[model samples]
Target chain A: MRKKPALWGLHASPPGLLKYVLAALPFLVVVLVYLIASDLRHDVNHADKLLPGFGQMLDSLKDLALVPDQRTGKILLLADTLASLKRLLIGVVLASVFGLFLGVNMGLLPGFRALQLSFVTFFSMIPPLAILPILFISFGVGELAKIVLIFIGVFPVIARDIYLASTQVPREQVVKALTLGATQLGVIYRVVLPQILPRLLDTVRLALGPAWLFLIASEAIAATNGLGYRIFLVRRYLAMDIILPYVLWITFIGFSMDWLLRRYMRWRYPWYERGGN
Target chain B: MTDTLASKYQLVIQDVHKSYGEKKVLEDIDLTVRSGEFCTVVGPSGCGKSTLLRLILGQEDVSSGFIYIDGKPVGLPSTDRGIVYQRYSLFPHLSVLDNVILGQTLRIAPWSARSKRKAFVDEAMVYLERMRLAEHSHKLPSELSGGMQQRVAIAQALIAKPKILMMDEPFGALDPETREEMQIFILELWDASRFTVFFVTHDLEEALFLGSRIFVLSQFYTDQRGNGQQIRRGAKIVADHHLPKTPLSAETKRAPHFLDLMESIRRDGFNPAHLQHVDDFNLRHPDSFRTLSPGEGDSQSDRMPQLWDKSQ
Candidate 1:
């Protein structure tokens, strides 16, 4: 028999510390590369807007986060984040309510399924961005249009995912519930609804990416105050400092939402099997 | 006919037939169960025993004929009947206590349920204690062993105080030792509670050991439908036997007569080659009866004399 090398083959298992180091390696490499590139660019052009130095980026962050705007007396970063979060929150909440309603009903009731399945599937297929123009025209390019765009972009997908999850709950469970004296509505709301809630959180977490995409796209095209609006407004001057920080902030917020939802699901539904549906 | 009345019997099925389009599943089915009989049904795979159980549970409707429970036609599934499947009987997201209480909770309005929660919990705990799962009441179904999960499932079903309890291969997923233990446990519960039970399984030994009355439902039976390719014959209750309602024990399973009975059921129900003529079925139970259709009688056996003689 041949001697097996450690940490290099199919038979090899890396220790815990090594595994953590390996996971962080890629992130470290990316930062190192970016820092070197920024330094090199700054040496060639001190006034470079393409890749601002760390000090310059920090100064830009401090201004946007701490200093009030001269015209509006509001911190630019805080104001933009608040505006974007409001639209995102309202849009996502509305989408979740509608999605859960449609999905649970469609999954449980044959008649509701027959009436809605094909139509929702068709609507899901239509590119949400392609209808942005129509939405802007119909609802006007105000907060309503932007929120509607986000809602339209994510609801169908969430509903479809939730429907799939709800259907995966064994027919045995439903029959058992019925035999346990649950009425039709009782089975749907009490039995099916609770079982699918963790799945709902999961679907919402997945929807956040597209929700952010639609929100940013809508704000960039029309909004006067938002993270997306500021990023686009600063783009012409090639203000990489502000753009980079705003982009990182958005990523952080998205990550936190996903993490929070996952934690809540685990805490609330300790019985839920992740990735098992 | 009076003997088969729902008022006399706990459950009665008359000339029941079930099919999905042209694919027949159950045909000319007639059954009458007493209020406290532990009736076990054994059959080959796809013999429609589970389908029959489902029909009685009111989860699915029969294609033709009728089912009566206590003289009222069986409607959609309700608290009057309780079922425990081979698996997924307990709600996965609920703790054992909560699952047991679910039936009581669901029976009342939400507002009333909250006020009556303590009473439901107290009632559920009694059943859980009987199942010896009181210590694990707060644990989720996923946390329990297969046998323990099934015990919880039984507690969950029994808490509702259903008129009849339906178990569809409830012990099929357990290991042999656990299965035997569960068999004894259920027998104890049945003896104590005296709830009418309709248990289904493909395991012949299990059928013989668990049932006070055993029914063999098999598709491998001859009828006037003949052996033509176009003729589709569904499963029928080919045999019914009444076993002595003696005290249940594990040692009884190893007795010679028990093994012999198991062997005969295997031949009668599970063997596709050993087809029995519908007229010659061993319906020896006092409660057993059959309502044969015009085409299902022995007179039509003349058309397929060879098969009929071979079956005899």
Candidate 2:
């Protein structure tokens, strides 16, 4: 049967140029709502830190970013960004390596799967925030504690997701590799590893949200510098101006990281996408 | 070596039986194939033809007897055997050439080592040329047609130079024209290389066209195992016929003797009531034999064992 694209319906193919504006519609509406709320709140009180106006927000960001903090002798925004980024990078790198190793082994070997699957499943259930006091008391409110918290929070989920992806690799492919002269280890690293790399990146992207959550929680409870620490420190004065910009900056960084990772997956593995994974 | 019977056979399955708990999937499978023989097996769906292929491939255990390849007992699947499924056997992350060269690379130096990689690439290129896939070598398997992909799979398997190439419906996913073209393509490659093959397909006609010897596996046959009751058994070789290895031509399909043999095989294996006695089964190949030992529960009606010679 011959079928053509329809103008509008479930099978409709919209004009390409209209797609861009349509995607931006909801985002534009959210900004407008916040702007109106900020203006109305400012009108009621001449000085309102709860929902600062656009000008006040901009000035607060400039002060935090360009000028040095009087107490800390550091550009608060730059220093916070660096400190937060360092922890995030180390934590995520460690989690990815550990998760990939654990998950792949669990998938390929029956004994390893039986040994570790339950333990990993149970480990992922422990809430990072619930153990915050224990971590603080043990690691003593240092960078180690914050980094470890993020690691514990993100690693298990990454491992579990990677395990699932590894298992989902078609059994036929493994058999085919064996038939083609691959040993057991050869199948894992040579045949299976390349197939799972993209899925690992996708899992990391999904795990980023919780990584940030754990980072912020740890910093809020105990830290000298970080975006999360700065946000909490300003909360005593209700400096919404500083808090809002910091929150926005954090979101922008997370979004960019996710996007870059996704693009990397696509670029490195063109055939994987074609495999319709 | 010449004194032993098993040495004459390229693959020997002796008293091979398989079952899952109470359900029997294959039983009394004793078939031996000679070296360089293109043996095609056709059977009705669910007759466990694929299971038999897996047993020979060492992907699954037979549950009873031993399978010897090149006079060596087979175990878990290894580089000694090569297989091509209907699809998805090729690594998607690798290019067509990479897929074909995987055997050589994994057998050679570490993946990072490239000192003699050029030799492996050159060997792969020759197989690619034979399969008419040389130009598409650098492209991904996803970029090729179904027939092209199967060709690449064949080249991939053939490059390794395994003892036997086992293909399970290798061209089943292709269109009619592509399927015929691939059948002929494989025949040409086999005629040149003389690699032993164990091809499984449900299409009876394709079996006649491609095989130097055709094996019909079916569950429709009856035997003397039951005491006036039906014995629940699985597929076995109901018939085996030797075909001449003529170079590819469409006219052989239209020949009267070929048509008659095809029809008889269809009747012998496809019809439930036409089951011949176990001894009288039409195993016409010179290499064919029934190594029935001990209480297989035989009766007086079983055919007498003989050294089969068409002249006799």
Candidate 3:
């Protein structure tokens, strides 16, 4: 008879150098395949076709270093991209902190979620573009409007996700904790918070994509420097070379951000076995 | 009839009644558990066995009765009464060790004799080791099986060293093999710990095995005219809830003794009128109590101290 696997040691395989070698094989294969295929693809050049082969694509990735002269525009674009990244990063941090507080409060408290959900949905429904005019009118077309826009874009999704996560924590656990001499706050921190955190980690990562999308849009309109503004500038002069490269750069950054998120999720929450849920 | 207090007596529950919105669940339940007695309550589903447990723990309100633990009214849940639930009520986020130690942390009396948090933790580890869950201290509840999770739940409840432990079908969800193993494990643990336990189960055989005394709760019967009735048609305290006489702990379902008791109970279960007839028949022919069959006679009484002193 086959014995059931010991539940405690489900993930406790002994570490070995060979294990890492074995695990890396699939990823290494994928990388090699991508590199070979990218090299094989060639493109004919036109004067208007500023974006050339994958070599130019690789060069543009390297060209993040800010240079003077004709490259100054590109360098300024890189700086703007970095600034946008910084703002998005800050917005995520702030929203997560604030959202957790509100989400938990709303989750635990009976009437609070109903009241907050209506208001959050109302605000979230107002498209980021629609709010831009009001934000510009109020805070001017500067960093302040951009920050508020990012906050608006990111906070609702987080608060809602947290609300769902915190509320979704099993009722039995909460009741058991309370009955076992845990104070209300003790129940939240000790029992409720731990269960909610992993899903919320996924939530925040998911929210980052939209946050970047809205931030880029905000920068495209009013900002003089940033990657979005630079992209718009290159578009006006039909500088497809610069425009296309920055687009590729944005895609790569987004892809890397998402990949890192996936890796972190896998490392921290291996028990989330149900894929594509 | 408050005679001599048993040597290791811990709690005395006297007439605890619980009702919700005029729906009385437990009506006048009275029992006193000695320090090490494994008293189990068994009945059909929704027979207020759970309500009796909640009343003892003081987690729910008693509509018209009271419970005393060590001769004091139980106002609310306390660490002195540890409860192990059937469901996996473990905090999923914390590791097994942390879950076990949660009860001992924060809000313990500052002036108490037992100081130092690490000592309490070490003591908790000993209980975990008893359940064979010591090595999984760092693993989260999600990484455990149903049986392992229940063991951790038991370890956590026992960690506080409560005087009276209450368990609600702790082995209800496990498979038959695991269930029997858990039953034996709990029995041994109770023997070692010497804490009085109040266990609730729907299985009568389980009740007979584990309980030093068994309290049968009346079924939920609703009367007409919009009132709820607890049909206590043939309800009374079966004082000696211990195993039957004859050194025959191996209970066969086909045995005359077991079959008579099961048949008698089954007849009462389906027909309330038939239950009253059985009682009347017993009363009319007290000397010839052979209706229950000769084999079932004195089976329960045999486990008692002696036949002469049994009534007293």
| Best model number under TM-score | 1
Error of 1 at B288 (Å): 1.5
TM-score against truth, every candidate? 0.95, 0.94, 0.73
Model 2: chain B TM-score relative to the native chain B: 0.91
Candidate 2, residues A37-74: lDDT per residue as tens digits?
98898899978778888899999899988999898789
Q: Give the alpha carbon lDDT tens digit for every residue of B212-282 in model 2.
A: 99999988776666423347776788898999866588678888888998899888888876766666788
CA lDDT of every candidate: 0.89, 0.85, 0.66
- Candidate 1 all-Cα RMSD: 3.5
TM-score of chain B of each: 0.93, 0.91, 0.72
Cα-based lDDT at residue B19, candidate 2:
88
User: Per TM-score, what order, best first?
Assistant: 1, 2, 3
Where is model 3 more than 4 Å wrong at Cα?
A1-45, A50-74, A111-118, A121-123, A271-277, B1-36, B51-77, B106-117, B220-312
Badly placed stretches (over 4 Å) of model 2 are: A1-9, A274-277, B1-3, B226-230, B293-312
Which residue pairs overlap in candidate 1's backbone? Answer: none
Q: Is the docking of candidate 3 incorrect, acceptable, medium or high quality?
A: incorrect
DockQ for all candidate structures vs. native: 0.77, 0.70, 0.20
Badly placed stretches (over 4 Å) of model 1 are A1-7, A275-277, B2-4, B225-230, B300-312
* DockQ score of the complex predicted as candidate 2: 0.70
lDDT rank, highest first?
1, 2, 3
- What TM-scores result for chain A when each predicted structure is judged separately against the true chain A? 0.96, 0.93, 0.74
